[model samples]
Structure formats: structure tokens, C-alpha cells
Target: MTPLIEADGLGRSYQQAGEAVVALSPASLRIWPSQRIALVGRSGSGKSTLLHLLAGLDQPSCGKLAWPTLGPVESLLPEKVALVFQAPSLLDSLSVAENVALPLLMAGQGRDSAARVAFALKTFGLLALVDKLPQTLSGGQMQCVAMARAIVGQPKLILADEPTGQLDQLSAQALLDALFRHLADSECALLIATHDPVIAARMDIHWHMEHGLLSCGERTAGSV
Candidate 1:
């Protein structure tokens, strides 16, 4: 079967404090539909950088990155990939529903926006908080809202960077469970960059990175 996203010989580098630092080595990966995987690494281990490349949020310093396929025949633009950062990354002024609906609304999908917002709220257990502001919610709740907003547009792929990084243990587990439940129901391929062992243990596939190189783990039952 064709892969939903692919990256070949992908690498990224940035100059920090007068030193050229390589954030990611030459790496290649493929994510098929409905797969839930966790990318594990300590800070500065290239997890976020690889996630950016996978999501097309940033271009690789070298190699090819693609959606559905890895070439010009039909490579998806950044808009087709939904990214959820460690921070909520929500608009400070927007209401919960408005923020959740922002992507669809931007796509000229006004009629479907309301329904999408409602469904997302229900999924995140935030139905009553739809009118609340981001400032009023706890870190966990805010992250849920952000996750909903990310998926509202129904992109083919979802990339997350340490999504549960800020929450307590229980809250983090709840968030991961809700996220995996949603993935079980959607076609959105998942690539979550995380360091939590609890969350990493639940993934169908797992990869660990050190010095910018990722080693694939033993395949679990749910891995593609």
C-alpha cells in the first residue's frame, strides 16, 4: 500500500551561538493510514525537527518529503498536514469554539464549521466550555481544544510535538487516550513526538532518537 507520508535522507540544521548544529541526521520514515506512533527523545534530540519535516512545516535541508507520495506528481502542501504543537498555539482572543472552528472557517467552510466545533468539543469533553476563553482553561483543557482545532480540517496527517509535556500524569494519560481514540476513528495518520514513557508504551509503533538518528523499535500488534 502507498504511504500517507514519507521522508527520505531528511536532515535539518540551524546555527546556534556561532555554531552550526545538526538537529536531524539523514533519516527516512513512512507513516501509513491509521497508524499511531510515538517519537521519543530528550530535548534537542531532533524529535521536533523531524516532526516539522514530516508535517512540511519546514523544508528539509536535503532530501525529499511528501504526502501520499514523495514527488511532484501530487505532493501535498503544508495546509494538508495538521500540526499540534506542545503549546496550545491558540489565538488569545478567540473563544474555544471560534478557535476550534478557525481552520474550517479559513477554508471557506462556514456551514460545516459549527458542526465540526461541536464534535470536537464533545470529543475533548469540552462541550460546555465551548464559549470559554483559552485563558480560563487549565493546561490540559487548553491542549484538548488545540488538538480539536488541529483535527477540525480533517487533514490526512497529524504531527504533535510533546503534546502532553505540560500536564500532570493523569491529565497527560487522559489526553493521550482521547487522542488515540480519535485516531482509531479517523484516517489521519499520526506522528507524535514525546518523551513520556507512559504514552510511549501505548503506541503501536515506537522510535527513539539520539544524536539525530532514530532506531525503529519492535513492532507491536497495532503497528502497520
Candidate 2:
């Protein structure tokens, strides 16, 4: 079977002060459907760079990245793939339910299709805040809403970048449980970038980044 995503010698760089600055060195990895991967690295270690490349938010400075089975990279987002950024980028003008339902709407889902939106809110424990705006919610609540939005479309893959960074330990754990449970039920692949060892421990595959280098392998026991 074709991999969900494949990167062949993928890398990214930028020109800083007329000199080339390497943000990520050429790295290769194949992400299969329904696979769970954790990307761990310190700040500026190229974790975000790699995530952006994989999400097709930014093109790699060199080499190639492809979604062999999904066809065009642009066509995959918000449908075949979803991205949850580090910060909750919810549309403030919309209510919680609207925010969660936005992706589906953008993907051509009709407004009459509220069942998917309702399910996502209830699953993420955001049902109570459905009518509320983002500004009125707590940081944890906003994060929950973001996750709800990401999964509402039932995308084949989710690319999350430090999704739980703003929450307390307890809330983070709860959110992670909900995320994994959603993925399990939907059979969706997840590639998450995180700094927490506990979060990394739960993933099946580990991608470690350091000084622009990326190395990936299956998680070893007690390696967290």
C-alpha cells in the first residue's frame, strides 16, 4: 500500500543576512495511515519547521515531500489532513460550535449537517461552551475547542504542533486521552510535535530533532 505521507531527502533553509541558514537538514521518513508519531525537540530544533513542511503550510527549501495516495498537497488539508497549531487560532467572531464546525463548512459540508459538529463538541467536552465565544473560555477550554475543530472533519491525518502547551498537567493529560481516543475511533494518523516527555511516551513512533537534524525510530521501553 502507498504510504500516507513520504519525505525524500526533505529539508528547509532560509537566507539570513545574505548567508544561508539551515533550519532543517535533509530527512526521510514514511508515515503510514493510522500511525501515531511524536516529534520531540527543544525550541528552534526544527520541530516546527518539519511539522510545517509535512502539513504543506510551507514548502521545503530542498528535496521532495509527497502524499502519494492523497494526490495534490493543497487538496489534502482540512479534509484528508488537519493541523492544530500551538495556539488556539479560533475565529473570535464565531461561537464555539461554529469554530468546531468551520472546517466541515469550508470543506463543503452544509450548515444543516450539525450532527458531526455536535459529536465533536460532546466528545471533547465542549458541549457546554457551544454557544460561547472563544474570548470567554479558559486556556484549556480554548485548546479543547481547537482539538474539536481539528477532528470535526474526520480527516485521515492530524498534524498537531504543541497542542497542549498552554494547559496544566491534568488538563493536558485529559486532552491527550481524548485526542488518542478520537484517533482510535476514526483510524486517523497523528503526527504531533511536543516538548513533554509524558506525551512523547504515549506515541508509537518517535522523531527526535536536534540542531536541524531529524532521526526517527520506534519507541523503546522506558525511553521517555
Q: What is the RMSD of candidate 2?
A: 1.3
Per-prediction TM-score: 0.89, 0.95
For candidate 2, report its TM-score. 0.95
- Among all candidates shown, the one with the greatest TM-score: 2
- Candidate 1 per-residue lDDT, tens place, 1-224, comes to 89987778888988899997889888887788878788887887888888777766677888877665433422333245778887568888999999988878776787867887898778778898989988998887788788888777777778888887887999888877777787776777777888788877777788888988877676565332
Spell out the clash pairs found in candidate 1: none
Predictions in order: lDDT: 0.78, 0.87
Q: For all candidates, what are the clash counts?
A: 0, 0
Output the TM-score of candidate 1: 0.89
Candidate 1: segments with Cα more than 4 A from true spot: 69-79, 220-224
| C-alpha RMSD by candidate, in order | 3.1, 1.3
